[model samples]
Target: MSEALNRNYRLCEEIGRGRFGVVYRCYSLATGDSFAVKSVDKSLIADDSVDRQCLYNEAKVMQLISPNPNVVQIYDVYEDDSHLHIVIELCNNSDLFHQIANQVFSEAEAAAVLAPLMAAIAHCHRRGVAHRDVKPDNILFDEWGRLKLADFGSAECFREGEMMSGVVGTPYYVAPEVVAGREYSEKVDVWSAGVILYIMLAGIPPFYGDTAAEIFEAVLRANLRFPSRIFHSVSPAVKDLLRRMLCKDVSRRFSAEQVLRHPWMTTT
Candidate 1:
């Protein structure tokens, strides 16, 4: 597989790194078109471990939910004795995290960034995939400035009417139910997306803490607030949508589809 990958694409400069692998910029040997390849270290995945399962699940889930404009496209996968390589769309604008970290965001700007994501999540839910992790770091922008959702390593497949367990997600964006270790549905993704919206509009997370434990504690409380200093100019329509998306009660929380239909999302 290594030889095959080398023959098909020339893996070049390191672009990013994660828990088990490093991402490299690669080019198609036949056409010279650029792409990003994530090479996961096979040795780090213990047999029958959650990490091993997630390694394969990432590819499987991405393959299932892609071809949509907002989701990163997976091209090919190869594995050798030491590494597993996944070729995916290259997002040149870094990630949403870095893109917004130093800037102020308006409701219109935030909606532009979030609408496609919510639409993508709605598509995933319709296909039975729950993107257990939905944070700014996992959102990227392609060369055309299209928002692309990347990284399905923490994703899971579930049936409608059924719930999933086992906590999974980044602290700041994890759903309150996930923080409480309770069964959660795909609505968890909605919650995480809501957190991103909060950060975008206010330039800070709704729940905060100095550590993971403190963050989880804050999440469990599920407090939703907007400081007047920052949100005084924000509209009620957008705030209403956020409250629904970030609702502590899963039953009251907006689904991704519902989010797409919200007034703010549809407004010009």
Candidate 2:
């Protein structure tokens, strides 16, 4: 498979890295198109089958959810004795995580970035997919400035009324229910989005600490706050929408569809 891939794609440079491996920007000699190729090291995995299946499952999930404009497309995948290579859409503008870290974002700016993501997430939910990890890094943009939701490694599809139990997600963005180790549903994704929204508007997470444990503790307390130092200029209407989305009460947490129609997202 590795030998065949070279005929189709010429690896240009290392573009980025993911939890699994390093990503390279590749070009198709046949089509003159650019693509991202993630090369996961096979030697790192003691159980090769598990790694293979995990990657295969992620690819399948992306195929099921994609052809929609806002989701990353998995173009092709192949494996060599040394590495497993997955071809994906190349997002030239980097990701939302770096954007949040490097700049200050206004409410309108944040809402504009979030509107497409919420719509994409809603589309995933409608198809029974739970993108359990909805952090800033997973959101990326192409050269055309269209943002797409990337990374389905932590995503899963669940049936109606099904409950999932596992402590999964980035520590800072994880919902309280996941930390509590309770049976949870797709709504946990909404909670993650709330955390992302908070960071987008405030330039920092609502719950934060120097360590992962401290942050987890802050999440468990589930206290939402707006410090005047950061949010003084933020509007009441924006905060109102944030409150609903960030509602620690799972029952009150806004769904992605509900979030789309929220006053903050809809208004000029």
Model 2 bad stretches (over 4 Å)? 48-53
Q: Candidate 2, overall lDDT?
A: 0.86
List the candidates' TM-scores in order: 0.97, 0.93
> RMSD of each candidate?
1.1, 1.8
Q: Rate the local accuracy (lDDT) of all candidates.
A: 0.92, 0.86
The positional error of residue 164 in candidate 1, measured at the CA in angstroms, is: 0.8
lDDT of 1: 0.92
TM-score of 2: 0.93
Candidate 2 colliding pairs: none
Query: Which candidate achieves the best lDDT against the true structure?
Result: 1
